[model samples]
Target: MKELYLLLLCMVTTSLGKNKSVDLELDYETASRLAGLPLHCAHVEYPNKLSQVLENQTELLAPSELHPIFYGCFDWHSSVHGHWLLAKVANLFPDTELHQNVRTLFAQQFTEDKVATELAYFNRKWGKSFERTYGWAWLLKLQEELELFKDEKFQEYAQILKPLADYIADLYIDFLPRLSYPVRVGEHTNTAFGLVFALDYARLDGNEKLIEVIRNVSLTFYTPDYDCPLRYEPSGYDFLSPCLQEAEVMSKILDDDLEYSVWLQKFLPQLFAENFVLEPGKVADRTDGKLVHLDGLNFSRAWALYTITKKLDDKDMVERLNAIGDEHIRTSIDNVVGSDYAGSHWLASFLFHALETRNS
Candidate 1:
């Protein structure tokens, strides 16, 4: 049995390298490997920080003790998106061991009681920014994935997680109004990156208020922004393109194709050029957590470019962007498998997001 599994894994890995199309889907073995990562770490806690404020003695607790459902993959947001990756893979390969692993993990960790404990941490005095918008966005993305899965077990998991999801949605509605300015950083706290995922979930779940808030806030923050200075982009530790992230959110918020085209023209006019080029971000050291973020930057840039292409009607432009997206994916998709723990722990989710966006 072990030899058979190894043979199958090798076959899948080989097939992945041979198929280099822009629409390349994650084969079962690749999905299983990526899903296996989170499954391996979902419970192993030690290299963990609560990212919380301690109001009392009880607040100083181990990660698993504090966040029963999300205490692994090095941090809160990574753990959340790790679960998202698992949920995605399980849906893709429902009859495989990947599904069984997700089922077992969800059954053990996604109980209402566990989620309540997770929620309690968020309700703490200094918890308003616990995971801030990044973690909150991913939790909603997980909920959206769960809601989409037709399996009864996934539906149950969605129901179990709905309260937490609802809380995050409410937080967005309350938080966005009070947020005077959007965080335009290329890292975790970037407001546009947060809104992109939250808006996706809100639209899918029919949360009118949440959708309205995101749309309004996005336009307010990003509209009239011209000359985004892509040349000055990619600060040393950036995992996201601040300029592209803004473009991503605005693309969703604006409904009119012409208006969006006009907005993109002003927002990222460089893209409108006939021979525009965006080199994939380079990572100096995969073992260095911050440096490895460049890998993620490549994937995210691909996602943003792919998303922007959807709103455009220019066939040549779309084709060019699609090729660029493929270049970005190729640069990092291979690195995802054998990178240092710093990169391996979370990069797969970004890769999955990029590929999923391309295939969508």
Candidate 2:
């Protein structure tokens, strides 16, 4: 595998200042570093955050006991997407050491017993809405990536993981309609961000129910939207870009390029301007868990804006998008590879997702 790595992708170097530049590419070294964060923490259960509801003293269980598969990486959602990050990286670079390690980890973790325990936790009284759409989306994303990878063992893992996936899908189907308005926050509850991945998984899984619910929810919440407050974006402690997340989700559901472009222009007219300038969010500190969200904000904004660029015929706007996208990546990627657990526990998944969306 190390020998084969010599043929791996080259790095993309971007200038940070007069003489300083950074490697923010999707090459092997960067990918390996990103994948390493999750591989190390996915099963390390200490220093975990449990956002659970306790029915009684009997429910005072450890995170590993509560979620057999997703009990690490700081929190349940981060753990779920950490698995997703590994599956995605392993999918891209199969026959590698990273892929083998991921295979081994999944074999140990993605068993019927583990998934059943996880599902039971979800089905518990007062636990139905636990992790809600965020963790659900990541779990679906993990299954989605597993199904896309080439290995037969990944399919087996996906099958073992399917019951939980189906449960989350049903949660979406049940919850979307009853909600009168979308959760437009920039954090875990952001409806648009959750729907984007869930919709992708739904379409891939051919779950028409999930797909239909997502489409209806999108149109219901966003079709009438206009003049999104992108300039007021990244409210402190924010990760997902509220404005761009909505636009990106709409880009997928619209009927045609013309239709989507029109809707986008109406919704976010600044993108149509001659010199549309948007800078990445600045993180003043990496040690603070909430403050570090700005780093993820930069990456997520890039991911959403990159998807919007695909449907654009405007060459200048697309170039602006690509430039800002790279800028966002370069701004926040260092922290993803840093030692601080505040950002390291989850930011790699955001970086990988942003890079994947940018490259795709």
Candidate 3:
């Protein structure tokens, strides 16, 4: 199968050069469709509809050659998309056997290599008990548990997670000097998610100690000035903006602050006012003069803002998010390839979250 794909890819490349109409607008959807070409080799010619690509790819994954991990890819990006799809499938088709099968498979990942890989990271750094700085990516993976296993199922897995949550709380306060630096602030999304998850875990595990941990971390991100910070950027990857927003949301929910909630309500539309434009059914990257993605933060501002704004129930905000989501599907469905898949996956996951929030 690998050889066949390589040969077909070679042929496609050769053919591509000869064609003058190979409109070079390569995005996630285009590449994802190209990758699917070999299987349904005759479904359509070179230029195909982007949205149809995944449908075709799904067909290719059927029966004896059923890649159990059909949605499997090891990176952070893959996990997000696969998890999003599993949740969507479960919610959309709760009674279907196939959906249940996929849900079970997704759930098993909690105890599988993917979980093991993350747990190993936690283990190596924090002694399997979350005593150290867990990266932002860990929180995203933690989210998979909520989708795959909630309530008692989550509690059943609590033994492995509970001590880690405690360790995380201790690590935060004990290493306050490190977490307090501005230059090291707001660099990842997983921080808030991690803290929120920790708090939830604490609540589940009946550990009141976690409440303080959650409060400090939550307030740290919501702190007005970066110079006096609570969240620290580890100085590597850039997933920070959303983390701050997530922290803010966590604060409001945990504290039940109507004022903070109002602040969020006001902040959403203001941020999206001039800087954002969702046109042609795709979320456009900010055209603002200020560096929106300073040093490879990329176009994260748009998505981060979109994620936070959707949480507010403002009628205008919801309408804007809906438009952005449609654009995301249109843009994302047409741009699925390799590392670029992350953007598509991000959109897919966001769409699922947005949809679920609406339905909820």
Candidate 4:
């Protein structure tokens, strides 16, 4: 039976070809299962160690105690995007059991009091840089999802979450001017990855101030960048591709497709090559929390590539990027489930983002 199951898995894998359908049914199933995993796991056994300046011994609190709305899924950022995955899936598949589960969970967690506590945590003196731009970006992404959700319940939830989102936006506007250099890492602190999602949210909500700041900061930090060294990517423990992510954001901020195409050509010239290829980052150990980040690197890279392809006029280049993006999704989507807390805790959100962004 195990051998047969493996064979069936192989067949399913084989079916996900360049021209094959994305299998939204299977995607929805995986999203439902993975999103449900961290929704109620308040006693997260392995939370991310945070930077804290405790005034007293009594001030130190457990993850659940400190972050009432987002205290699960191993870390605050993971928990933030976990809720994002649930919200996205629920909005897309409203009649499914997954949607119902999301509704039930939101009822308990999205209360005004809970959000107020969350806001207070951010406003704390020592917690100014608690999650910084990474967590802040996911919060805005979640708000964007909630704002887009047409359900009255989700709209109410969005309204309730507005104060915290506004706080994070204020942080971005204040922080970017002071940041003389952008962090070019492949991890959570990557400035490009943060700005991309935040920019999206700002545009959707018509926040001119946030939008202008993002555009100016993005151009200031990235406009002169050229020939990003893609071959040196997938730094150990990396979850975001620095080069591709920057390119992705530039594609959005540039004025016109002509400008974007020119910028992309200068930024990642290898994409124009007929034989250019990007293999997905391999993970040697899923049980190791940091090592598994390579899998996320693949998903996020795929998202960037897919988004970049949309802005280009070259049909051949677009098809090539699409194929590569599809391959990256295939590499990691199947592993989003399973019992490994290290990877399972947050990978589904990356997988969901990759597939949903590509297909959308």
List TM-score per model, in order. Answer: 0.94, 0.93, 0.49, 0.91
Computed on alpha carbons, the lDDT of every model, listed in order, comes to 0.85, 0.85, 0.38, 0.82
What is the alpha-carbon lDDT of model 2 when measured against the actual structure? Answer: 0.85
Tell me the lDDT of model 4 at 38: 54
Per-residue lDDT of 1-360 in model 3, one digit per residue for the tens? Answer: 344334434544332211334433333322322433222221112222211123244344221122222223323323434444444444455455434444454455444443444443434422433322333223433443443454454434433343433444555445533455323334432455445445554455555655565566566655443222212331234434443445344543444455544545443333335444533222234232122122123223334444454455566755665555344333333322211322332333433332343334
How many residue-pair clashes does candidate 2 contain? 0
Error of 3 at 200 (Å): 5.3
* Candidates 2 and 4, the one with greater TM-score: 2
Stretches off by above 4 angstroms in model 4 are: 1-27, 40-51
By TM-score, the better pick of 1 and 3 is: 1
Task: Please tell me which model should have the higher TM-score, number 1 or number 4.
Answer: 1
lDDT of model 3 at position 154: 40
lDDT of 1 by residue, 299-327 (tens): 99999999999999999999998889888
Output the TM-score of candidate 3.
Answer: 0.49
Candidate 4 local lDDT, 317-340, one digit each (tens): 899998898788877766665537
